[model samples]
Target: MILRTSRLDLREMTEDDLPALRAILQDAETMTAYEGAFDEEMVQAWLHRMRDRYRDDGFGMWAVVLRESGEMIGQCGPTVQHILDEDVLEVGYLFNRAHWHRGYATEAAAAVRDHVFRALGADRLFAQVRDMNVASMNVAIRLGMTVRGRFVKNYRGVDMPHLAFAIDAPPTGREHGVSAAPPERRRER
Candidate 1:
């Protein structure tokens, strides 16, 4: 599936994205925010695993591209996360360091959240963020997600606090401040 925003294109991952994905995954600053740095082999395996998820589940994290430049900036989508109690479809994303502070993550995440609820019929969506990542926390809030709880676990063998956020359901027309009918219909064409 491909989703488009004003300046971005969200599409499925391709084999050609391996080099870009690997570079993003290996950046020490970006990896510091994530669990750990991924080697080239690990990155390729991750791509393969995501491909399998797409085949089996019909959805997975998609590559985010710049519409004007056609450059891959990051990935964002739903994934089945196995936490302590049960499995849940969590919305996740990561971007290249060069793409930071541009609102790309928030914009991409908002689009994904809308798709998950409106198109995928997801009743709820969740996101797990490390406590130290203030930027991600803001993204969760901007997406209208409320923190459900936290877990103290070893993420990539480092003891860190994980914060979970969830949105119960999609917003209705009224919630979006949009009228049910078109302006021409509401008035007189």
Candidate 2:
């Protein structure tokens, strides 16, 4: 499956994307929210886990490829997260540092948000933003989300404060559809 936007094509990642994945996941600055860069083994496990999510959940963070360049510039989409003792579907976005400062995160996330509300028939979408990461918070805000709660997440051996952000599906059951661009997909294998 491929979710297309004005400039990106979000699709299921394959093992062949390892090198590109490393460039993003293994970069220290780009992964500060993850606590630090991942080592070779951790990176491999991350990729395998995403593929597993595809098989088990039918959706996961996708490879965000720039259509013009065909380079995987980031990762964005939804994942089921256990937050505050509740299992919620959350939208997530992470980009290579080189691609920061542009509006890609917002564009990609909004597309995924719309898809969940429209195609997936979800009533609400969520995002868990690390307290200090205002940039990511901004992306969630741009998707029309507002902080709904907070919690401490123990990840990478540290207690991280996170703000839960969420937006309900518009009453019309759709938005203007920045991400409503048709996707090219075959039956899941």
Could you tell me every candidate's TM-score relative to the true structure?
A: 0.87, 0.89
Over 42-85, each residue of candidate 1 has an lDDT whose tens digit, in order, gives 79888998899889988898999999999999999898886546
After TM-score superposition, the amount by which residue 137's alpha carbon in candidate 2 deviates from its true location, in angstroms, is 0.5
Off by over 4 Å in 1: 171-189
RMSD of each: 3.7, 7.6
Candidates' lDDT values, in order? 0.86, 0.90
Error of 2 at 5 (Å): 0.7
- In lDDT terms, which candidate is top? 2
- When summed lDDT is taken over every stretch of 10 residues in candidate 1, the lowest stretch is 170-179
Per-residue accuracy of model 2 over 1-189 as CA lDDT, tens digit each: 468999999999999899999999999988898899999999999889999999999899999999999999999989999776799899989998999988999999999999998888888899999999999999999999999999999988999999999999887613653343344432321
Residue 39, model 1: lDDT of 83
